[model samples]
Target: MPRAIGPVLVEGPVEVVLPDGTVVVSERPVVALCLCRRSRRYPFCDTSHRRRSRPSVERPADGEQA
Candidate 1:
């Protein structure tokens, strides 16, 4: 059997196969995968959201929010 190493965080449905041909999946809306094996929570973003620092979008008076 091959060793599998990963902590992939998934926002949608996903499928994985182990070296022994073991399949893994989640029946939920969100999933987290581990990367460095340092995550105590393992996989899920522990407030590690990347900030773009994008300026606030300005909208025209006649324009509707998309």
Candidate 2:
């Protein structure tokens, strides 16, 4: 019998039905739903959970300070 996986993490395609009767389909072998509302792919985790690097603010050497 076919059954729904979860809002939890899992592998393989997933079909999500919204309250408005909208159906969202994902065919990824490993699907990650966004819970933090930070994913650019909204509802899909595009590895946005990874830490982002910030620009360095340290000054350059005296001779290289152009």
Candidate 3:
């Protein structure tokens, strides 16, 4: 199933065929397929999509120590 911010869970030992005619296989009993396309390991989920950017903290000037 697809989640709002996660991968699609699938029963594994599955073979994925990419658009480029490349085939990838996984033999795990379960698999997480990347839906966000942000996975370092494409076609598989590495939880990369869950990462959120943090706001930058303001730093004091060099002469003025915090």
lDDT of 1 by residue, 1-66 (tens): 654344455776756565688776766677765544455543433433332378997776675655
How big is the positional error of residue 46 in model 2, measured in Å on the Cα after superposition? 1.4
* C-alpha lDDT (0 to 100) for residue 44 of candidate 1: 39
Stronger candidate by TM-score (1 vs 3) = 3
Query: How close to the true structure is residue 20 of candidate 3, measured as C-alpha lDDT?
Result: 100
Candidate 3 per-residue C-alpha lDDT over 1-66 given as tens digits, one digit per residue, 9 for 90 to 100: 745688889998999999999999999999999989999999999999989899898899889877
Q: Candidate 1: which stretches are off by over 4 Å?
A: 1-7, 37-66
Candidate 2 is scored at a TM of: 0.51
For every model shown, what is its TM-score relative to the native structure?
Answer: 0.36, 0.51, 0.75
- Residue 65's C-alpha lDDT in candidate 2? 61
List the lowest-lDDT window of 10 residues for candidate 1: 42-51
Instruction: Tell me the lDDT of model 3 at 27.
Output: 98
For all candidates, what are the clash counts?
5, 1, 0
Q: Please, what's the RMSD in Å of model 2?
A: 8.9
Candidates sorted on TM-score, descending = 3, 2, 1
